[model samples]
Target: MTDMQVQRHAPIREQVANILRDAIVDQRLTPGQLLVERELCEMTSASRASVREALRQLQAEGLVESHNGRGTSVTVISTATARHVYQVRSSLEGLAARLFAEHASDQDRAAFRAAVTELAEETAKGADAAALLKAKSRAYDVLFRGCGNPVLHQTVQTLQHRVTRLRALTLAQEGRAERSADEVTAIADAVDARDGEAAQAAAMTHVEEAARVMLAAAEGPPSH
Candidate 1:
């Protein structure tokens, strides 16, 4: 079926949720921006039921918050919260890298290398944030698949979605993209060489760098 038809045939709430999630992550719906139910329905051409259901899902994901009188708004990640999130992410990613190094077959390693190359090329070409997010996700897909832990993979996916906005912010910082690409290359190199310890360290380093950039950007420049 065509994409449009597929959307119509699928569960309406998920379709609406995906559209709203993309908007929030892409910053079209900025942090602290109010989510008006009527406006969302109008924008997505979905019904009230679908919009409300979608908002409920996003609220559960920590991407949207609702106050009794104030309604819902995109979540704003404070520096402290970002730091905590990164701490958890670093540990989980370290475990993932070590596991991948231990478990990845030749074919899996080849796919991981291909994903790294695609991400590097995209970064060098100065791809937009959305394109870069997709490319980065492709690389993570290889890691997730090779790691051999469904529970860990699913947990990381949830956490990744929660931090998508912060991640996009980090990617926008000056020189951050090149640095991030290099970090991923380091992780890939360690995995290729079958050094589990080095791979884990490389993955942790990448998360640490991302946390640094994201926290600094979230804080904004200090006033003179």
Candidate 2:
């Protein structure tokens, strides 16, 4: 194929993967929802090859499962997976916080402060779920990028994608917005103070709270 054709089709595979990943994260696909190749191809307006390649990538990422006769479906988020994800996330985010405290320039800190202010404003607006998610995502992106730790940034990026669905679900729980906003503020304060330990502590607490919220939701409503 020509260079233009190859470049054009590359985005198709990525687009397909993102749509499927979002569906899985939002729980629209759910665990074990069949990801039929023909259906996905039609839904994404891509060729069968692109859809198949996207599915293969998702499967490699542990977001999808495939079997000989059963076809592909969204992978179940087992307790083990949840724990492992949180463990890795905590370490990476903590490292990010520490690095930001130790190495971030004044300008970087200023940018982070602005991002935090924006997050606070967005949260106070009481926007819809999607808006809040986007705002929080942007805020975290700023934080990670400011850390000056490439490895930590990349690791958290992967973890964020893997747990996107859980994060969205947790955001739906009662009091999550308030809690998240408060944590964000705390993290900002710690980083601004240039206290690596405090920043790491704040970040770890924030993630732990999120994990608790997600686990509680996963357990379903309380019994009387």
lDDT winner: 1
Whole-model lDDT, model 1: 0.88
For candidate 1, lDDT tens digit of each residue in 1-224? 12222167778899888888888998889989998888887777789888999999999999999998779999987778889999998999999999998888989989998999999999999999988888888988899878999999999888878667777889999999999999999999999999899999999999999998887777789999
Q: Report the C-alpha lDDT of model 2 over 13-36, residue by residue, as the tens digit.
A: 887787778667767677878887
Q: What would the C-alpha RMSD of candidate 2 be, to one decimal place? A: 4.3
- Clashes by residue pair, model 1: none
Write down the worst ten-residue block by lDDT for model 2: 1-10
lDDT of each: 0.88, 0.80
Global Cα RMSD, each model: 2.6, 4.3
Error of model 2, residue 41, in angstroms: 1.9
Index of the highest-TM-score prediction: 1
TM-score per prediction, in order, is 0.93, 0.87
